[model samples]
Target: MAETMIDVPGYKAGTWVLDPSHSEVTFSVRHMMISKVRGSFGVKSATIVAPENPLEARVEATVDASSIDTNDEGRDTHLRSADFFDVETYPTIEFRSTATRVEAGDLFVDGDLTMHGVTKPVSFELELGGFGVDPWGNYKAGATATTVVNREDFGLTWNAALETGGVLVGKDITITLDLQGSLEQS
Candidate 1:
């Protein structure tokens, strides 16, 4: 038998909590002029709300900076040091959505992202993958979002120059968000 695709109804205009167990907040950046390095920050909590009568929504997310893990202790320590995230002074990275727009079935979340003590506006283009009741009797929804940001914009500009005349680290970082959330029915 062929696999069947289920079309789920769009999310109801209301508040939804992010299920961390099923959601991952990850990012990738160019490293050593060779390849890209990837990492994920553990999310503490997040909430999103959409009003029934409006086309916009609000989102707030908090991430634990100390949870940065790139599979290497040395690199992780360096990232948390003053040269990069400076996690000692700034323990959390936060985002609060200012506006949301839907285009071609994708949701663009425009928000203020605060990292390394600097706040900047960023947009995450998201697709509402789908939602439904799971076999275990839980309502689940999924979304995928992608965005790019300059490290300098968030005050994370530490880098070294290579002999070949290029910086060791790239300025632009690509962030990919694969989120699976559960609805808490009231």
Candidate 2:
């Protein structure tokens, strides 16, 4: 059990390696000002250094930029070009926690998110999924976090004006993360 200000049961203190196979980084943005386009990036790697006080934990993660999948090959390719991610120039998206605290009874992690070679402070509202022991005896923990960012703020300003009204893509993007990690016993 965690002795932190927040109520997280079975929270173990140790270094945890992300279970990339079971974790995901997904996002959605309004398309054509009517529908939404959802996509996901494969997790390159993530690690959590949890202390007895969960609020003191440090999280570091990297997401593969070229792994973006939006169900459209052309758009994905475009996203990898100079107009967007430009994987050739910026191959990875990274996040490093700067602070963590309980706000209004909810856990929030403040971090620096680097994408498209731009770094900006972002906050993630975290929801603990509790901890458990898998059948193979590995101690595990999971959580879901989300935050919204303006694409233009990160320099992803590629969009075409629609003949009817708004632009082709929305500026605000919603990013959600479902992460599971295994505690590495020393």
Candidate 3:
């Protein structure tokens, strides 16, 4: 099957740096098999390299593992420990695109996601939020992408079993990207 291609006007070929103040990387996982726990990672750096052919575009992003915030200090500490991220050993989570394509007006990116020292292939569906000039007169573009992954696959397997049933934490984690970036060049 052939993949669709999009010519996003104003999303011209160049390097786009993700604006940390305007962008977010978040994740949610089932807690106690009944509730959900959410958290966000502070992005250390991110860049999108769009080529003359948009399908050839590439994405590179890094998140500060130690900056994970879930609003609870105690839980945050555990998340940074060996039980979860082991931030001291693996300081950052990174993603690098392997392929990019357009389908149904949305961009599909296949990439290698590295977390907890494990690397795996993952895919994200990105919806373009459009491009425009920001208040600071910088040309900007926004997009949102999401994907679900298993924590265990990344070596983040620490968990407790509930006596009643199920487990303390679920395996599946939903990751979301609310990305906004400024064009370095047109």
Give per-residue CA lDDT, model 3, range 51-164, as digits (tens): 888788899999999999999999999999999999999999999999997666567899999999999999999888999997888889999999999999999999999999
Kindly give the stretch of ten consecutive residues in candidate 1 with the minimal lDDT sum.
Answer: 1-10
Q: What tens-digit string does per-residue lDDT give for candidate 2 at 1-186?
A: 422555477988899999998899999999999999999999999999988887899999999999999999999999999999999999999999998988667789999999999999999999889889999999999999999999899999999999998999999999999999999989
Candidate 3 lDDT trough over 10 residues, lowest sum: 1-10
Mark the regions of model 2 whose C-alpha exceeds 4 Å error after superposition: 1-4
Highest-TM-score candidate: 2
Question: After TM-score superposition, what is the CA distance of residue 22 in candidate 2 from its true location, in Å?
Answer: 0.7
What lDDT tens digits, residue by residue, belong to model 1 across residues 82-136?
A: 9999999999999998877765555577899999999999999977788778898
Winner by lDDT between candidate 3 and candidate 2: 2
- Local lDDT at 126 for model 3: 86
Error of 1 at 22 (Å): 0.5
Off by over 4 Å in 1: 1-8, 103-106
Best by lDDT: 2
Model 2: how far residue 105 lies from native, Å? 0.9
